[model samples]
Each structure stands twice: as C-alpha cells, then as structure tokens.
Target: MSLIRHAETSAPNIFHGAESDVGLSEWGHKQAGLLADHLASRGAEAVYCSALRRAVASATPIAHALGQSPVVIPELHERKIGPLSGRTRDEGWGVYEESKRRWIAGEVEFSHPGGESFADIDRRVRPILDDLSKRHKGGRFLVVVHGIVIRVALTSLLADRTPADFDAIAIDFASINDLVHDGSRWRAEALNLVVAPSPARPVA
Candidate 1:
C-alpha cells in the first residue's frame, strides 16, 4: 500500500493539526491533479483517506482516476496539536518540536498540553492499517493522509527504524511512502518520494 501525505494546505505555515479542518491551497489543487495523473498507472484498487478536508481533497482526484470513491477514516487524521492548533511554528513556542523530541527519546506518553501522545496516535492508526493490509492482501491500495501520520507509521512499523528517527524523516506534501505487507510484517519500499514538482514555499 502507498501512504501519501496530503497536498499543500491553504495555510501551509499554520498548525492545522487534527482540529483545524482546512482545505488545499491553489497550488495544492494543481499538485493534487498531478498526483492523480502520476498514480493513474499504479493500478490501485481502492483509495482511503483521513476524514479531514485536506486529505479528502487530496484523495478526490486520485479516486476519480481509479474509478473509486475514497473511504474516509477518522483514525487516519493528523496528530492533534491541541493548544498549538492554528498557530505558526514560531508562535507555538516550539512545543510541538519538543514533544516530538521526547517521543523520539522513548517517551511515548509525552504530549503537548492537551495534545495526543505518540502512543495515542499509534493506538488509533496502526490497527486500521493492519486491517487494510489484510483485506487487500495481494492488491495495491492508496491512503491519502498527513505528514505526521506518515512519519509516525514509518517509525512504528518498520523494524530497522524507531521513533528516534522521526524528526529526521521528512514527509513532503503529496509525497508517497510505499509499504508492503508480507502476510506478517510491514516493510518500506520507498519513502518521501515526490512525484511532481512542489510549490516554492515550505510545507506545513
């Protein structure tokens, strides 16, 4: 299966997190179209996405290209940033980054004030992905989701990697992280692969 970060958001600099429900930027829309075009030849049988607006918007074109409607999964949403929601990185006082640091250092319970812990995100997300892998078995599928979600999944699921590598892993907007299930464990095939040129601005 392929886990794709959603296209650039309408507010790329702000911390939209799970609560903010924003859509794509103008360039993001074009990026989504290019994403769809690129994935058209991949023969994905199903398309799944986070229920958040940005994820749904990103999946729309790809689902259309594959002649399937996107299955919305709430558990696949971005990690909730809680108090930092809607704030720019500078305005948020680096709380998010610090929380990530703690999480990577084996403090799975660490969280921003009112935000979810690494364990919280893992609990909600991993089961769904495992189930999807079982259901698809030998088939290919696509999941449009957030960068943090992708990063968390990679750190948790890949045996050679751990949360310590989370911050070092950069999941760019619309980039695809490909994984394969061997009827037992998940393995990475590719990661952070941007299929199309991205906008000049930095990603959220």
Candidate 2:
C-alpha cells in the first residue's frame, strides 16, 4: 500500500494541525496534478483518502488517471486536533511538540478531551487495514491522509519501542509513504518522500 499526504494547503504553515475543511492553494493544485502523473503508472487498484477537501482534491486526479473513483474514509481523517486548530504557528507547534513528547514515551492513549485520541485512531485504523488486506490481498492501493494519522499508524505498527521513536517520522506536504503487506505483516518501505518540487518555503 502507498500512503500520500495531500498537496500544499492555502495556509502552509508548520504545525497547522486539525485544520477544518479547506481546499488546496494554487500551487497545491499543481502538486496534485504532478502527484497524479507520478502515480499514474503505479497501477493502483483503488484510491482512498480522508473525507476532507484537500485530500479529495489530491486524490481526484490520481483517481481519474486510474479510471477509478476515490473512496472517502472518515476514519482516515487527521486526528481531531481540538484546541490546536487555528492557533498561531508558535502556539500550535508548542502543543504538537508536547503531544509528541507523550507519544514518544509510548503514551499512545493520550489525546485532547472531546477530540480524537491516538489510541482511538489506532482503533479506527486497524479495521480498515484488515479489510484492505482481506479484500485487496497483494493488490497495490493508495491512501491519501494526514501527517498525524500516518505517524500514529506507524507507531501502532511498532512492537515495543522506547521514547523518542515515533517522533522520528517526518511527513511533508505531497510526500509519499510506502507500505507493503507480504501476506503476513505490513512493513514500511519508505516514509515522507516528496514527488514534486515544492515551492519556496516560508519560514516557520
């Protein structure tokens, strides 16, 4: 399976977590097209993405290229970021870092009250993966999702890790994360690979 992050957003600031439904920026649309071109040859059986505008836009072209439609999966949405939503960059970044500190210590169950928790995310993610494995067995599928979701998924895959481990994964916009299921287990082949040239980045 291949996991792809949505292309750039209207506000491409760091630690911009838990953003509500928003569309991509001008360049972000271009990134989606480039991403489609890049994945057109991969022969994916189906495209799946979070039920958000950015994810839908990113998956649209890819789905078009594959002559298939994207399946919107709410379960794959970025963990509800709660108070982190729409915060200033520094403030949101601080909250994200602190949250990671907890996650790194293997506190996967931690989360904002009234928002989606990492443990809850794991609960939602497992069934999708299991379904994919059973239905698509050996088929290549693509998932367009959020950074936090991707990180939590990987963390869930680890057997028993120490502190600061899950924090190592970095997901950039329009990056590709590769996963393979070899009939028995899922293995991560690559994480956070950018397919198109990104625009000049603004300082965080």
Highest TM-score, which number? Answer: 1
Assess the local accuracy of residue 122 in candidate 1 as a C-alpha lDDT between 0 and 100.
Answer: 89
- On lDDT, the candidate that comes out on top is 1
Each model's TM-score?
0.95, 0.89
lDDT of 1 by residue, 32-128 (tens): 9888989998879899999999999999999999888999998899998888998996898578878888988999889978898888988989999
- Candidate 2 lDDT score relative to the true structure: 0.78
lDDT of 1: 0.89
Badly placed stretches (over 4 Å) of model 2 are 14-19, 158-164, 200-204
The count of residue-pair clashes in candidate 1 stands at 0
Candidate 1: the clashing residue pairs are: none
Q: How many pairs collide in each candidate, listed in order?
A: 0, 0
- TM-score result, candidate 1: 0.95
Writing each residue's lDDT as its tens digit, candidate 2 over 100-125 gives 77777777777655466677777888
